[model samples]
Target chain A: MRNHNVTIGIFIVSGLALFTLVLFTIGNEHKAFSPHVDLHTEFANISGLTKGSDVQVAGFDAGEIADIEVPKSPSGRFRLVLRIDQRLNPLVRTDSLVTVDSEGIVGDKFVQIHGGSANAREAAASTTLPSKEPLSLADLLESSNDLINGANGTMKGVQGKLDGTLDAATKTINNANDLIVGIKQGKGTVGMLLRDQTTATEIQQAVANGEQATVSVKQASASLKHASGQADALVSDFASRGLGGKVDQTLLSARGAAGNLDSISGQLHQTMTEALGEDGRGVDAGGNIQQSLSNLTETTGNMAADTEALKHEFFFKGFFKHRGYYSLADLDPTTYRNDRVFTNPDNGRAWLEAARLFEQTSNGQERLTTEGKLQIEEAIAELGDGALNGPLVIEGYSSQSDSGTQLAASHSRALLVLHYIHARYQVDLRNIGAVALRNTPPPGVHKETWDGVCIMALKASS
Target chain B: MIGIFDFVGAVGLFGLRVIGSVFRIPFELEQIWRHIGEAGVRSLALVLSAGLALGVVMTLHTRGALVMFGATAMIPKLQSLGFFVEIGPLVAALLVAGRVGAGNGAVLADMRATEQIDAIEALSMDSFKFLVVPRVVACVIALPLLTVFMDFCGILGGYLSEYTLSHISLHLYLTRAFQGMQWSNFVPPTLKALVFGFIIGTISCFFGYTTNEGAEGVGRAATSSVVVSSLLIILADVILVKIIFLTFPGSAT
Candidate 1:
């Protein structure tokens, strides 16, 4: 019986001890026996932060939220009372930033305390730390939506500009089509320059004439220069032989004759001025006859003296007499004399006559006739010459429709011509190119009257 | 209808009579100690086994559910909360009602059938005081201690199970287990265990003390004690939990 009592007492004591251990562990978690400092902070939106939520210092758990109160002084904010470990109180400074944080995207909320600088004063017990509200998922989503909307608007603006550019490009392509048609039909100056043999011949003749005129001017300038040199030598010889006086006498006689002639000319000018009298204004509007007669006689005398000095000084005479190479005669303005035309073989290779090669329809649908094959074969053989040996460009034409359907139909027609030529001549396929021109036909021909692929040969541009 | 009223009256009188005899002089300390040994010491191994089994089962079940929420790491905390607030006390009480209540009912019913209780009464002794009072007092005292033992064993069992699967150390598991617990979580349920002990003792003693049909009545008494005590304990728990929540709002969460 005593043993039974002892065993029972042992069990009871053990049970009590176990109970105390559990209670103590629970108390430790609650900080019931630990020395702690109470700190306070205010947040506008704690975001469901509750009492007993962890208070962390620099990501390490230092304490827990002890209480949460809504003071009447601040309407929207809740003041959180934090119980921090007393040992960590020195690390918590006045300038430390406190923020409400969540463990993960959807995890429990906690209060995070970022330590202040070393020089900052320690925050006293019950001091309120500054707090920043935690970011909410809704706010993040709204900002992301704004960014996406901005990017979407920018992309839409770029698409609008791209559409505008495409429209302009289409217009430019249509203008090019019109220009190609005009060239094919020999309708404009470019066409005339290409297809009109007479104009080409005239251009060649003009170029030849310019070359001949250049040669003639060169010869004439040379002759004049040689003649001037001879004159200079003769004058120098006369001066060196002391025969300058005789030459001067001769020039004096010439100058006297010129002076008499100048006086007579002045009298003739007076007679004319008197016949055409200025009655309305009573002014000599035509001439001052007596001053003119005296001035002419003095100029003739000065010229006679100057010429006598020039005869004595041959260097001045030679300088005055030398003529330059360029002259009015050098320009052959009427027509060039040389008629040798340098015709580019490549120029004649464009726009072959395909009347026999394709049957024309008023609706602008072209098909190869039986005779058309023969004509194509002949044209191919002709183009086989070394001068025109290059790519055979078949430009198909469609008018009245700019739709892709018409464009595709024109392409089919050009492809038919390309295949026909390829099969018959065994020509290298690389030397053939096909194209479709929409809303255009050979220039100067109406859409109702024209239908054919203009078989033009391409020669590499030099 | 008369039997129903008689049964209710008898149960009410039995409860009142037990209360009246609680503070009588010349207390039966020796008998009380013996009953305590019988109720608490003899039943300790059973309680420990039940608690450990329940803890391991609960840990595995909670892990199954909590894993879906990616909260498998909260197993220790969840187990602590479950055992302290609801499982530990109730389980320990039910276990006590089965072992102690049946033992007391069967022994007292056998004594009455053989006229042992009457023999004591004829000697001018308080038979209810001698037999029922000590047993009731012993149950009341031992239940809380047993509940604490159950709690300790349960937490240890949960830690073992969690450690097996998650490899968490004993220290870490204990820390995590008790971190969310408060005094209120531990107190209210333990106090409610006292009420459970009282219910089991009084109900079983009432059935056992009134035995009249002879040997067959002993079996009925033992069976009835277990059934009645278990039902009443559950019903009382519902009310006690409500009161506890109202009294300590934090523990209610």
Candidate 2:
């Protein structure tokens, strides 16, 4: 009976002790015995946060949610009554932000109170802290879906433009390619120049004649200056001597010298113009030498274009792609606007209005302002971290009345922005290009015309 | 079917008489204590071992599924919750029903077969109060305490299994295990074992004390005790769980 009593006493005591341990451990986790203060917050969406969910202050477990008051209407927020440990009351402040957070990607939701700034006062009990509405997974997915759909539409448009551009580029390359083949067979003017020794000889003679004419014109100009000086001395001497007949003889000789000098200068001018063409006029008014040289220049230009096309062609592109042999320097406005490099769907662009970006100096020259530089910096930031990795183009636009003024203003704006970016960011000059669009915005840029500069960060095709 | 009803009626009448005798004067405190020692202390090792083994198996089973969800940290919590909320009480009752239920039936049936119960009646002592009330009262008092022991042992067993795999600290495991628990969750399920103990003690004692067939009936009484008590405990558990849920709605969490 004594042994039985001892064993039963031990068993019952141990069982009760274990039960008490469980109760206290659970109570400790919940801060049930700790002194606590109630704080309030309201959220438009609780995001499935239940009453008794864990409440954390700056990621430290504090207490559990005491209660949740449902709103009277859909627009009204759900008021949450949070019970926080009094020891952590100092961390809770009037300016502290409250948000709904979770344990992991798909875990239980909890209330998180971000500590307020040190300058703020400690929050009083039952004070309603500002709450940020939680971002639900459904809302996130919906926004992303809309973004993806917009991106898809933009990509489709870019694809259509790219196809058209590629087709045109292909036709241009083929024609140039045909011309190259013709030249190799000795069919074009360039071929004739290469094959006909007589034409080459004549070009050499014309160049020699031009050189001689230039020398003769220099000699004639020196003689006219000398003759004028002599005439001035003779008139002075005649005035001093009062010799009328001597003045008449000297004047006649000066006239004859002036006539000869004029004749020589005229002949030189005519000969130079006939060989090299007029100052602004092209090969049409020029002699055969000028026309032949023009044809030679055109042929070389076609060859250069063909070589560039070959570098991008499927067969040879692999060689140049990774070697960094690709150049954006020679990109013209037409090609740039059509090329996938600038028009790729992944490219980022920021448009700053001209009025905001530029200020006119006293000399009537427009320059980038301090605010304009800040705006540019913000625009670059908006393009994101990868903005500097690829080719960047500054597209200048102007709404000036005349085409000449528009072109000048647009080009000036683009050049100013380009210089600022290069100096401020130290971006590689080779990786950046500038174009004066002269009032026309790029296709599908959401505007028909814009008086602004568009900074385009063109990502390389994947 | 009529025989089943008759047996149920007899059990109900026997239970009411035991309840009425429980509040009467000259209570069997010594006998209740002795029976508590037999039913609870003697059965402690079996309940604990079974609880520990079940805990190990439950952890191993749930660990794989929880790991796939990247929720392996929930293993300790799941273990404790499972044992406390349902498994500990149910398993403890069934084990007691198997052990003490058979013993109670066989001992009393032997006494009845040999006319010891008749000898007690002849001496002017109430045979039901002397032989049956103490055993039923002991069961009602001891089962819940045994369940508490079972729950803790199960949690410790889970920790052992978890520690081997993760080398988790005991503090962190215990913290996580009890982090989501509440008084309502623990108290209601544990108290429900009282009903289980009553079913086991009453059914077994009824079989033993009411046996009329002499020596041949002892084996039959013992078998019926184990079988009927086990079945009634299971049925009572289902209803008791629902009642607990209704009474304490927060425990559902």
Candidate 3:
């Protein structure tokens, strides 16, 4: 062979000699090679511990594990063995905890000690490390399950509310649908509008016309508002003159016109009656009625037949008569129209009211005291007036009575308010008697607790 | 079996016969030193390569089991445990035992077959004193030294795989590897290596020195020496473990 013989003598001797050398060299790593102490501990579970493990102080390696023994379950406690290097004894405290941990995943297990305390004293050699209970996987899963359950409960609550709301909304929508269906089948007023074709057509046409009329009404209202403003301005202008003077002037002119018209119309009427009233009053009495009508028309050609329209229109009847202070007798004595024309058919009176009121203050001809007379006269002399209310009391109570005596005095001091109808600004007195009544209960009701019924007895009006 | 016992007793007696041959060491050392060029130093590469490769295989085998739970990260620790605690020492010890056991047995057996041992006996010199003790002591000493060398190279091999495959920084790997170790991890192996070398050397030398006639005896001696040494190594390991680990397992680190 090219190679020298491979001797077992060379092989075996070389292998052993060098191994012994390195053993004592790396021995410096542990405190045992020098002078050191040892500590021990036991626990219920060692979990897969092996030798050569570390004792950690606050996650830092402080010592090596020195020994392990599975002692006979000492005093009923599970057997465990530990040996901690003594040089690191300063790091262990009485309150320190010891636990077993795997060096790596699925690796050999070792005992890890978490040591230290601010107030705890230094632990002695052979000190037992306290055991700690760690949170288990089961605990984690339970809490996670609880959170999921809570989330599920929240979703269920929201689902229930949504379901109720949807049901109510669906029911409401169904009712609305039924209403629409009823209308299509022609029930009630709404159904009539939808189902009656003639009524619908007429209403449609009316609505069109009404829409047009609405425009005219709006324009009229606008014009009337402007004219009313102008009227107000004119009235304001005339206020200094007092409307009584104009009313007096109008009454005089109407009297003069009536006088002139009465004499001429009377004469004409007599002549017509003697000429045609008797002889041509009937068809047989007349000589050729057509010839007479023609002759009548020829003679009256200078006259207007339109004068008859004046009677129907009340052109001869002044609107002021019913509302006027003067009666027909107060007209100028020499002037008159037909006497019956000024009469009111409803009252069969020639005037709205005929009365005399006289007041005297310290005068023998007086029938009333001035204040009483003024009050009554104001109430009575108003044109077209009637009583609004019989009378009401205005009682004033003094503050002194609250402390002194009876539960307040009731008395009457004045009449109630008079109301009127504004018929186109003509204030016609209308019968009315309504008053807003308020009765204040006495003050100072003491505080009361619930669970009791409190009754109040009402007093009839005295 | 009785004859076998007598034969073993005769061999033990022959090996002790050479204890007085201490004066022959200088020449023997010279020869050993000369052969060191070939056996130990020359074959150092093969030894180192085989040791390193064995370390890698050991590291991977242990790590693969641990990695089911993703403990490959702890391979340096495991490799350290295997090498320093068991594999590193055992592999190197067995290698030396095989390599030295067969060689010693063959040489002695060949010398007997070639009539060289008889010639030494005729020369009025104690053949056992001249030949057996030097080789036995040499093997006892040399095998452990070789094992130590193998251990160092195996550690390096473990580190290479760690650095190459797992990317453990040298600083971190060295630190963790050294962390779980104690004097016991190293001392027990080296001491055991010494015992192992003695067993291998004495048995193989004994087998060959008293070997039956012919080349067949030489072959049988060499083969039997390897087998016997291997079995003795396992038995010594078991006893040593009880002494080291069982006696003081926790503090052994």
Ranking by TM-score: 1, 2, 3
What are the per-residue Cα lDDT tens digits for candidate 2 across B171-239?
899888987577777888888888889988999999999997887799999999999999999998888
Q: What is the alpha-carbon lDDT of model 1 when measured against the actual structure? A: 0.78
Can you give the TM-score per candidate against the true fold?
0.59, 0.59, 0.48
Name the top lDDT candidate: 2
Backbone clash pairs in model 1 (N, Cα, C under 3 Å; residues 3+ apart or in different chains), count: 0
Q: Which of the predicted structures, 1 or 2, would earn the higher lDDT when compared with the native?
A: 2
Model 1 lDDT at residue A95? 89
RMSD of 2: 26.3
When summed lDDT is taken over every stretch of 10 residues in candidate 1 chain A, the lowest stretch is A333-342
The best-first sequence of candidates by lDDT reads 2, 1, 3
Worst 10 residues of 2 chain A by lDDT: A277-286
Off by over 4 Å in 3: A1-21, A24-29, A34-52, A67-91, A122-129, A133-462, B1-43, B60-68, B182-184, B212-253
Q: Can you list the residue pairs that collide in candidate 2? A: none
Query: What's the i-RMS of each model?
Result: 2.2, 1.5, 5.5
Q: Write the per-residue lDDT of candidate 2 for residues A312-404, one digit (tens) a residue.
A: 899989776655464655657776667655666677899999999999999999998757877998998899887777788899999999999
Clashing pairs in 1: none
Q: Is the docking of candidate 2 incorrect, acceptable, medium or high quality?
A: acceptable
